[model samples]
Target: MNIHQVSVNYAPEQDRLLIRINGKEGGELRAWLTRRLALALLPVLNQSATAQMTKLAGPAAPAASLDEQRDQLLDTFQKEALLRTGDFKTPYEDRQGQPANAVLGPEPLLLTEVKVTLMSSGQLRLQMLEKLPGSDTVRNFQVMMDGQLTNGLLHLLHQSLNASQWLEPVAPANLTPAGSSEVPELAIEPAKPRYLN
Candidate 1:
């Protein structure tokens, strides 16, 4: 699908991340990311991003190291650069006067399986699946995202995860603000919705 916009939000009652993607062709896809799935997805997402960034950096990419801090610094730099070009300030446009053209169905799929692949074209392909509760039927959808969009999706997901507090809290000393140094931490509060375009 040609993605036009994406929104990920944390639903406290459901305790799951609701991911909504609006396609350029006016079709929408919605999925639910549960805590168990989110935990499993974190490592894969990180590995794919690291690999893609290293490939883009070519031979100039820094050598793999045991220094965790150094690796985090590099990741922070890349994320900041990507966020600069993102269009998060623009609110996600809602389909007006009628229900959205949902690709799978009107209900959001409870994603039971997700496959991540880095294609030869340098775009990441995500195949999401939902196994019907009492049937052999399974519904699936796929989306291709470039590096920047991948980073943006990851960013928004992280914000949702942070709000959900599904993981342990980090030490205050380890906390660092996102975006440029000039931008205060309050500017990126969890209450604000982030749109990936």
Candidate 2:
């Protein structure tokens, strides 16, 4: 979508960011971009950090202010999309003699939408919605983080959006009963997918 206008306002009490993106085609997207996600995108949108520094700067252009930061964020975001068309890697492994390769069931279902959320712990939570070949039935899968990620990896995430693919998801050992108020020490958990919806 061609973006026309954008805004980012911080809510200190809520520790949240209010982002509104207006597309040229009249579509509007609104979301509360979490602090971690904003932190993650800060470097990408910062002028001094990315390669766009030289080109985006012209003699008359003004330094990035609060308003421009939102524009920069939107500019940086177009390249980094949230939708998952059809890119997924099945688990694989190789051993000494047997060469144990995890069996990849069948061709993966077409992924309709994927949501990525940055947790306060500096980790990302990915929830994917995939559909069967010729039906409306869609199943959801999450790219589960097996362990705590290193600070370096987390830092790299600020630099690169594609770093998400490097993560792997696994099925939970035991399903938690629905409506369980207990946090599993892990965030396990869609709609079609929206910036905030």
Candidate 3:
């Protein structure tokens, strides 16, 4: 479906991020992202965004040749450039007063699994699923996002996460690689991506 707008907000009471996607064709898809899922999903999102940035950079400039620091700087520059051009100031249009346009159901889907892959068309494909308890039921939904939309979604998720105070302890200041003076042997493993068919 063609997306019209995307919204991500933290719900303090639910302690989860509410993602609402309004399709240009007239339906809205809502999902709840819990802390556990967010922790696993954020890194994958970052990786995918970086991949897109590198693809846009083209074959002339290979990201592999650059040092870690330089590559990071380039990624930052690309992300900022794309983000600056996006129209994030416009408020997300929700189907509140009008007839319910929730395509899934009245309540948001409680996401149990998420998979993401960069498509051949240079768009990010996202698949979110909800597995019902005590039954063999798994409802799924899919959406494709361009680089700008991916970056926008990442920005929104980061803002909501900060507001939720869930990453305060592991904030940028506190993060240290293995064998550092501040923290030692920080057994952090690289994010393993899930394959999507």
Candidate 4:
């Protein structure tokens, strides 16, 4: 399970963190997180507008209600998460082969499993792998953030991964030869994957 590339981003207003992952096996997974663990990112916003937001929304501020404070907290996460820029990479689609105005007709990729691995590099990475029908190989990917990780943040990560639909299969409506119930043929065709544009 080799990871090709990982792109992580956060939107504090919505309290959402997104990890866009690309795998060598030919698919992608987008992990969208929405919760309070994002507040752990205060240190990252020390110099940003988010810091000002927090100060203005202090506990004693009559105008700063609980919801308003929550909004400011989200800003902090966004300010922090947006610091990382990543390019999505994959071996599946050759953009040069695609013609202009070509809409995607391929089936959706299935997210097989999600896991967390503590790397020797001192980063706690989140890994998600996808599987195609009939192929023993799975498209695996892993990504981690480099920063201060709070307990609430760690729990949020665990909660987000556990709540996702990654455990279910996202197979196509039309079954291919590999998924057919018919008897196997003497010669088998290679799996040609198609993905959205």
Best by TM-score: 3
Clashes in each model (backbone N, CA, C under 3 Å)? 0, 0, 0, 1
Q: Is candidate 2 or candidate 4 better by TM-score?
A: 2
Q: Which residue pairs collide in model 3, if any?
A: none
Q: Where does model 3 exceed 4 Å of error?
A: 61-80, 96-103, 170-197
Model 2 TM-score, 2 decimals: 0.27
Reference-based lDDT, each prediction = 0.78, 0.39, 0.82, 0.43
Poorly placed runs, candidate 4 (over 4 Å): 1-109, 148-197
| lDDT score, candidate 1, position 81 | 76
List the lowest-lDDT window of 10 residues for candidate 2. 92-101
TM-score of each: 0.69, 0.27, 0.72, 0.26
Better of 2 and 3 by lDDT: 3
lDDT of 3 by residue, 1-197 (tens): 79888999999989999998888877678889999999899999999988876675554444565586597777777755974366779999986333224356677889999999998777899999998789676767899998889988998999999998998786445566787766544566899999999
Rank ordering of all candidates by TM-score, starting from the highest: 3, 1, 2, 4
Residue 139 CA error for candidate 2 (Å)? 14
Per-residue lDDT over 1-197 for candidate 4, one digit per residue giving the tens place of the 0 to 100 score: 24444444544554455644444664555544333333333233233333333333334433358898777677666644543323223232432232221221132223444454444444445554556589976655455533333222343444444454333565545445886787544555899999999
lDDT of 2: 0.39
Better of 3 and 4 by TM-score: 3
In angstroms, the error of model 2 at 112 is: 17
Q: Which stretches of candidate 2 lie over 4 Å from their true place?
A: 47-50, 55-197
